[model samples]
Target chain A: MNHALDTRHAALLLAPLTLLMLLFFLMPALSIVWTSVHGGQLDLAAYRELLTSALFRRVLATTFEISIEATALTLVIGYAIAMHLARLTPSARAVMMIFVMLPFWTSILVKSFAFTIVLGDAGLVNRAISWLFGTETPIPMLFNRVGVVLGMLNFLLPFMVLPVLGNLLAQDRTLQRAAETMGAGPVRIFLRITLPLSLPGVLSGVLMCLSLSVGSYITPALLGGRTDMMMANLVDFYTRQTLDWPAASAIAMVLLLITALIVVLLTRVRGGNVEVL
Target chain B: MHNSLPDRMTRFWRATGGLIAWSGYLFLLMPTLILVPVSLGGSQQLSFPPEQLSLALYEQFFTDPSWWGAALQSAKIATLSTMLTMLIAVPAAYALVRGDFPGRRFLNLFTLSPILVPVVVLGLGFYLNFNLFGIGGSDLSLVIAHTILIAPFVVVSVSAGLRQIDPALETVATIMGAGRATIFFRVVLPQIRDSLVVGALLAFLISFDEVVASYFVSGPSTMTLPVKMYSALRWEISPVIAAVSAMLTILSLVFSVALIHLQKKSRGH
Candidate 1:
């Protein structure tokens, strides 16, 4: 305690963690990129293989399509909940926060399993439907894009609510009060003032949702039909099925770049409204 | 004043907003708890509102060796990783909070960089790293991989704890002739012990629940609980998995509640 807080003291304190990161994290991550570049030699064959394959191209497209759909839906639903949360008193907010967090606490696999039953032909939804419509035939809902998207919808909703709620709380309330006093309509106030101010949360939440959906494997594999594959499945398939590290590394790099690109674009769009995420 | 147009409008929107918001929350929350009912189903098939309430599936989960092994393996990995993460993150977070040095900001970012990368990529990185050493299926491999992922949370929790402490306590101890190590052991650790306990628990829960990375690294012999459940889900619809899932969900819910409660109390102080 008597020692000065200097570079030497800091370095000493940081050594164990720094060494851990170097050995396990940085080396492994760099090695993947390094492997992708040096497939038997310093060449671009892996990238070329990925680029030339029509199947890989389609998988990329499908990944984005599903991710975008899930991200948009999550933002809308989560914004509604977060807005509600921001308006509540502390005790009420705490109760409502638990509801948002319940799915988050549960495993993603459990949610997928629940949907497998909920959306299956003989599952709960169809059972209810048959009861209402006077029919015994089970509706085929699982093993499709709808089920896949719904599974992801369950997983990402909390991620959306949390960041948006944080930004909404951190937001200045007097600005809205000022707008109210100035006779701005509620719709106008929301559109021009409140919504604009919550952009950082909205932007970050969307980015998180999109990235997660794109990389998701379990939902698509367990809930979706054969055709609904996301990028994570591609990575898993390459690494496990084909044992193609080079190809896997290439596709992974591509996926990471796409996520990075989207993140950069959104942060750019947020412009000068930098705030804590 | 009597209700104006704007007043009436606000009232209407408020009512509708509450309905939509509550429905969205229920929609997000209720699906996962489906396992609770299905887990109790007396029938062989997974179903809600069980044909009859029974502990048959729970019995199966309890008696099964594969299930037991996976659970044990998961617990072992989670414990080892959490301990290792604490060992590293305590000092790292301490340095970041209390020390003054060059590249401090960069070190902070480095600790948190894992959160930016997708789990699949990290899983792949770990898979490759371990494969080179022929430790791909070893417990050490799983522990190390999970340690890397869980360490960031430890740093965050400890740093939060660090912020909650009064620096004057450490400064006073320093002036009273306590050495740096003595101050850390006797003064600083006592103040942040809540964070250390809760942080370790959170890290344990995180490692226990992790699937994607565990899936990549775990082989047949070294499979963890989540990975085992994933395999069961993929291979067939086993009712036992429903029991396992229900149990996992409850455990996670309790752990999260405890962690959040601790965090709230810490901040309340």
Candidate 2:
């Protein structure tokens, strides 16, 4: 009876959360899949059309290209910054990390807006560029790939930095010292010892940056030109502007599927022995 | 020869590394610095190192009723969503961490999947669903959407805190004849209090900053600061928007500092 009561209490405690998960989270996602398939009857036409569309292909290619570049840039920069932080004293490390994370806490809208102020024509960068060059015309920086990439990197830098920092902090420093004592150069030691050991962090950061960059809507929409648009911007354009729910749902399902596949591929590459579950 | 070559390479890499590090810092800080002068511009246009410096934009933000009302609405929604997230996530996190349960893995995935899905996708789905229910353009819908969005952060934070605690401590308290309720209230809750506070703060910030979902679900009465700024941006590039953004930046910085301070204090404990 006591065991039964314990089970009952657990069930009661979990019921509300379970209900929310079912109704709000799982249901919405499944509904997207459902809506995509059954616009009128069971049909693969939406998927077929989306897959074949040249615009869709272009958007997909743009998404992958931008995400890959962003991921690579973030990993290299983030890894170096994490290494620098790791070498600092604890208090300094804390202060520096706080700086690194400041943008993460700020609104994405605010960050993107701030970028516009810096990157826009007559904005800071253009003003400075014109002043330096003694030119009358402000450089066109906004409404371009430069603005979108800058905005994305501003928001995403911390995501890259934090995971790498976590792994770096957890690493044993004595091994690097040992490698140095054995006449291993700093570059060699870093590449052979630190970098190899930090693969998990690098992998995680890359995955995060890729996933985030691919799905980001606000940054690209506000900053990017039509040619600079990502898949997420397309999804928003379809759903919000055109009121094309079925097409939007189809695109979303494809995005979700592609993201899942990437995660799977990443997990396998990282180590198939580790249980993703 | 190879030894000297390696040494030279190391020196080159170190210099390159330092340059990259400085660039990274500038990249992070430069955009934020640009907001200040733009906010203070006397002219209506957003120009850096404004031809004239004035506080009119700040005044506009403060004096305008709609701006203040939207700010208040954002605060209200953030508070309500934070509370809801904490209530739901704490118990769920505790169960997942401490209890043996079937489908716990699935439950964990369910909590995290929201983070994986594009915000626009979620926004569209919610818009469709909420419109059908007649709550599409309501504050209630915004709160619900935000709670779902932020609950995962609460769960992650609380779960991290739970992992640091020793389950044996709770077991010993129970063996010493403490009631289950007493053990939970006295032992478990106190141990995880820092994480709970951090989680709640994070949830508040996340909900406060959320724009995509807010844009879709919120009515004019329910417009958040970000949503308001976004709409304003579509129409014009104004110094007023800059002032509003600067205020938000300062607010976010203060909250982040407070969170970091709390984390440091807990670490010291």
Best by DockQ: 1
- For residues B40-96, what per-residue lDDT tens digits would candidate 1 score against the true structure? 885477777678889988898889999978999899999899988888789889889
Clashes of 2: 0
Please provide, for model 2 over A9-107, each residue's C-alpha lDDT reduced to its tens digit, 9 standing for 90 to 100: 555656777788777767677677777886547798888888789998999998888788777778888888888888789988888877788888888
Candidate 1 similarity to native, TM-score:
0.93
- Error of model 2, residue B106, in angstroms: 2.1
Residue A171 of model 2, lDDT score = 90
For candidate 2, the iRMS in Å is: 3.6
> Which digits, one per residue and each the tens of the lDDT, describe model 2 over residues B1-269?
75786678778887788788778888787656667777887646777677788999989888998887888999999999998888887877877677666766667766766776778778877876777667878888998899889888888888878888878888888678898678767988899888889989999999988998888788877798879888787666655778888888888888889999887766666
Please give the DockQ score of every candidate, comma-separated. Answer: 0.59, 0.47
Candidate 2, A66: how far from true, in Å?
Answer: 1.5
Q: Report, to 2 decimal places, the DockQ of model 2.
A: 0.47
Q: Give the clashing residue pairs of candidate 1, or none.
A: A1-B180
